[model samples]
Target: MRKVIGIGETVLDIIFKDNQPVGAVPGGSVFNAMISLGRCGVASTMLTDTGRDRIGDQVVSFLSDNGVCADYVQRFAHGQSPVSLAFLDEANNAQYMFYRDCKVDRQDINIPDLHADDIVLIGSYYALDPAVRQQVVALLDQARAAGAIIYYDINFRPSHRTDVMKVTPNLLDNLDYADIVRGSVDDFEVLYRKQDPETIYKAEISFYCKRFICTRGAQPAVVLADGGVVGEYPVDTTDTVSTIGAGDNFNAGFIYGLLRQGITRDHLDRGLTQQQWDGLIADALAFAAESCKSIYNYISVDFGNNKQLPNHI
Candidate 1:
C-alpha cells in the first residue's frame, strides 16, 4: 500500500486565550499534517523525538488514536519532551512561546521504508537544523531512490530569522529535493523580505523547484509559475475558532487529493492537468477552512468522519 511519511518535531501545545489556559494538543508542523492524514484514514507515519516521560506517552497515544504509525518516534532519555505555549489574540491567531532542551543532534530516527509514488512530507526549522541534517538527508536520499514524491513546506517563522544566512544552503538543498514546495506569506517575508507571491516565486523558488504554492491568510492562494500555470485560488472563508492547524490540514487535504486522484511520481514530472490542480487546491482550501473552525490542531473528528473522500491509491 502507498503511504505518507513525515519527519519533524512534536510538541505539546498549551493554548491560552485572553491570558487564561484553554486546552492542550499535540502539534508540530509536519506532525500536525500527518495527524490529519491519519484521521482521514490515509496511511501515515511520523519520524520524531520525545522524552521518555509522561508527555512522551501522551504524544505516542495521540498518534495511535489518530491512526498515525508511531513506531519511528525516538524516545530520548536525557531530556524532557518539548512544549509550546500558544496565546491567542482577538483575531484567533496565536503567538507562540516554546520550551525545549537545546540539543545538537537526535541520531536514532529509523527511516521508514519508502515505495515508488509514496509521499514524504518535511518542513519547519527541523528541515534546516544542522544538528539533525545527516539523519534527515539519509531519509531524503532513501525517498529519492524509491521514487517517492517529496513535499517541502517552508514553515519558516520569525524566530529562525537569525539563522537565515547560516541555513540558506540547507534551505536550497531542501528545495532541490522537493517535488512540491508550499510556503505562507509570513514565511516568505522572513526569508526574502518579499510579499507578493509571484515576485517571490520568480526570484527565489523557481530555480530549485518547478511547483511552488504561496498562501496568504484569508487571501487567495497563489499557484505560481508551476509548469506555465499561474492562478490565484481563493480560500474558503469561515469564522475561525483557531488558526493553529489551518496550513497543516491544507497539506493533508492536498495529499489526500493526490491519493484519491491517483497522482503519482509519474504524473509529477509530466505535470498535472488543470482539472487535477483544481481538485488538489479545492481540497486544500476546504481542509484548511475546516481546521480553522476548531481549536484542535488537526481536523475535527466530526469532519473526518463525514469527509466522504475515498483514497483510491
Candidate 2:
C-alpha cells in the first residue's frame, strides 16, 4: 500500500472558548491530516521536529497512538516545544497566538525513502520558512522524481501577512512542486490579495500548477483542472463546535478517497473524470463536516475507524 508522508510543524493546540480552556490536542496543518489518515487505518508518517520536553513527549505519544510513524521526527534537546493558544470565536472559527522557542538547527531529520504513488502532504509556514526551505525543496525534488503525488496546502495565516513578499518566492516554489494545490479564500487573500477562485486560478495558480482546489469556509469548494474542467461541491451543514481542523480533515478525506480509488501519480497527468472528482470532493466535505462537530483537532477515533468511502468509485 502507498503511504502518506507529511512534512510540517507540530504544535500542541490549547483550545479556548469564552475565556476558558476547553481542550488540548497535537495539531499542525499537515500533522492533523496525517493523524486523521492514520486513524482511518492508512499507512502514514510524519516528518517534523519537536523539543525533548513534556510537550514533545505528548506529541510523539499522540502520533504513535494514532498510528503515525514517528521515526522521522527530530527531537531537539535544546529548545522547548511550541504551543498555540486557539481562541474560538462565536462563529467557531479560530484565531491563534503562538509561543515558540527557537533553535539554530531545526527540521534536521533524514528524509524517509519514498516510493511511487506515495502521497506527500506539505504546507503552512513550515514549508515557506527560510531556515528549512532547502531541505523541503530537496524532499519535494526526491518525491517528484519518485513519481509521488505532491499536495500543497496554502494555509497562510493573517499573522504572517507582513512577510508575504518575502515568502512569495517559496510559496511559488511549492506550487511548482505540487500536483494538486489546495488553498482557502483567506489564504489567497493574504498571499495574492485575491479571493475570487477563478481569478486566482487563472492569474496565479495556473502558471505553477495545473490542478487547483479553492475552499471557502462554510461555502462551496471549487476545483479547477486542466482543459477548463471546473467543479464545485458545497460544504455540509453541521452544528459546529470548533472549526480548528476542518480543512485539514478535508485534506485527509480527499487523500483517503484517492487511495481508496487507486488514483496515483501516473494517472494524475491524465486528469480525473467528473465522477472521480465529485466523489473525492464529497468525501472531503464529509470528513470536514464530521470534524466541525467536535472540539478535537481531527475526526474522532470512532468516526475514522468506521468511515467508508462510497462504493461507486
Candidate 3:
C-alpha cells in the first residue's frame, strides 16, 4: 500500500474557553492530518521530535493510539515538550500562543526512503526553519526522485507573520517543489498581503505552483488550477464547537479522496475534470465538517469508522 508521510512539529494544545483551560490535546498541522488518515485506514507515518518528558510521551502514545506510525519520532531531553495555548473567542475561533523549547542542534531526523505513488506532507514554520531545512529539503528531493506527490499546506499561523520576509525564500522553495498547495486566505494575506484567490494565484502561486487552494474562514473555498480553470466551492458552515484542526482534517479527507479515486501523479499532471475536483472538494468538506463538531483535533473515532464518500461524489 502507498503510504502518507508527514514532517512537522508536535505540540500539546491547551484549549481555553473564556479565561480557563478546559482541555488539552496533541496536535500539529501535519500531525493532525496524519492521525486522521490513520484513523481512516491509510498508512500514516510522521517525522518529528519532542522532548523526553511526559508531554512527549503522551504525544508519541497518542499517535500510536490513533494508528499513526511513531517509529521515526525523535525524543530528546534538551528541553520540555512544546505547548500551545488556544483561547477561544465568541465564535469558537482560537487565538494561539505557543511555547516551544527546542535547540538548534537536536533536530536530526532521518529522511524516509520513498516509493512511487507515496504522498509526502510538509509545511509550516517547521519546514521553513533553517534548523531543519536541510533534512526537510532532502526529504522533498527524495520524494521527487521517487515520483511521489508532495502536498504543501501553507498553514502559516499568525505567530510567524513577523518573519515572512526572512522565510520567503524557503516558502517559495516549498511551493516550487509541491504538486498541490493549500492555504487559507489568512495565510496568503500574511505572506503576500493579498486576499482574492484569483489574484493571489496569478500573482504569487501560479508561477511556482499552479494548483492553489484558497480558503477563508467559514466562507467558500476557491481553487485555481492549470489551463485557466477556476473553481469556487461552498464549505460546510454547520455549527462548529471548535474550529481547531478543521483545516488539517480537510487535507486528510482530500488525500483520502485521491486514494479512493486512484488519482495518481499522471492524472494530476494531465488535469482532473471538474467532476473529479468536485469529488475531492466534497470529501474535503465532509472531513472538515465532522472535525468541527467536537473539541478533538481529529475526526471522532466513531465518525472515522463510519465515514462514507459524499453520495454525489
Estimated TM-score for each candidate:
0.97, 0.97, 0.96
232-287, model 1: which lDDT tens digit per residue? 89876689989988888889889988888889978988888888888999988888
Model 2 alpha-carbon drift over 4 Å, by segment = 227-229, 308-313
Better of 1 and 3 by TM-score: 1
Q: Compared with the true structure, what per-residue lDDT tens digits does model 2 show for residues 1-313?
A: 7888999999999999998999998899999999988888888899999889898999999999998999889998788989999999999899999998865377556888998999999988999999888878888998999999999998999999999999888998999999999999999889888999999999998988999999999889999989364788887678999999999988999999898888987678887889889988988888888889899889888988796444332
Look at candidate 3 and tell me the lDDT of residue 273: 86
Cα RMSD of all models vs. native, in order, equals 1.3, 2.1, 2.6
Between prediction 2 and prediction 3, which has the larger lDDT? 2
- Candidate 3: C-alpha RMSD to true structure equals 2.6
By summed lDDT, the worst window of 10 consecutive residues in model 1 runs over 304-313
The 10 consecutive residues of candidate 3 with the worst lDDT sum are: 304-313
Sorted by lDDT (best first), the order is 2, 1, 3
- Residue-level lDDT of model 3, residues 20-104, one tens digit each, is 9889999998998998888877887999988888989999999999888999999886788899999888888889999877452
lDDT of 1: 0.89
